[model samples]
Target: MERDILHLTVPTFPITLARIAEPSLRERPVAVAPLTSERAVIQCASLEARAEGVCEGVSVY
Candidate 1:
C-alpha cells in the first residue's frame, strides 16, 4: 500500500520573494489588505503574522 501525494508544477512563471521586497518591505511585517480609506479588514497576513497566529480570511472588525 502507498499513500498519494499532491503536487503541482509551473513552467516559465517564477516568483521569488527576495526580488519583490523593497527597502521598506524588507525584514518587517507585511500583509495585503483591501484598498480603503477608513479602517479596513485584514485580507492576508505575512509570514511574521502567521508566526503570531494571523492568517488569511481573518476578520478585522
Candidate 2:
C-alpha cells in the first residue's frame, strides 16, 4: 500500500502575520529578532531580508 502526505509552511510566519496586521509591511524586508539587545540573534527573516543576506540565527546588530 502507498500513502500520500501533504506539507504546508508559512515562510517568515511572524513577518506574514505582521504584514496582515500592518499593510505597510507588505513586500518589505522584515526581520524578527530578539527584543532584548541590539546584538540579539535573528529569529526569522522575510524573503526580502533573505535576499539581502539576512538569515536566522544571525546577529541583528
Candidate 3:
C-alpha cells in the first residue's frame, strides 16, 4: 500500500479574517503582529502590504 501527503497554506489567513470582520480593510495594506512587544515580528502580511515591502518574519517596527 502507498500513502500520499498533502500540504496547504493560507498565508493571509489573519488578514483575511480581519477584512471579513471589517470590510474597510479590503484592498488595503495589512499586517499581523504582536501588539504587546515593542519589537514585534510580522506573522503575516496582505498582498497590498507585501507589495509595499512588508512580509512575514519582518520587524513590525
Candidate 4:
C-alpha cells in the first residue's frame, strides 16, 4: 500500500484574516507584529507591505 500527503500555506494568513474582518484593510499595506515589546519583529506582511520592504523577521520600529 502507498499513501500520499499534501501541504499548504498562506504566507500572509494573519494579514488576510485582518482584511477579512476589516474591509478597510483591503488594498493597504498590512503587517503583523507584537505590541507588548519595544522592539517588535514582523511575523507576516501582506503583498502590499512586502512590496514596500516589509517582511517577516524584520524589526518593526
User: Pick by lDDT: which candidate is best?
Assistant: 3
Q: Candidate 1 overall Cα lDDT vs. reference?
A: 0.54
Worst-scoring 10-residue span by lDDT in model 2: 8-17
lDDT of 4 at 44: 92
Candidate 2's C-alpha lDDT? 0.87
lDDT of 4 by residue, 1-61 (tens): 9999999898888888899999999999999999998999999988898899887999878
Clashes of 1: 0
lDDT by residue (2-60, candidate 1, tens digit) is 99999875321121253274556554566555667365666655666577776666556
For model 3, which pairs clash?
Answer: none
TM-scores of all candidate predictions against the true structure = 0.45, 0.73, 0.79, 0.79
Name the regions of candidate 3 deviating beyond 4 angstroms: 1-7
Candidate 2: clashing residue pairs, number? 0
Better of 2 and 3 by TM-score: 3
What's model 4's overall lDDT? 0.90
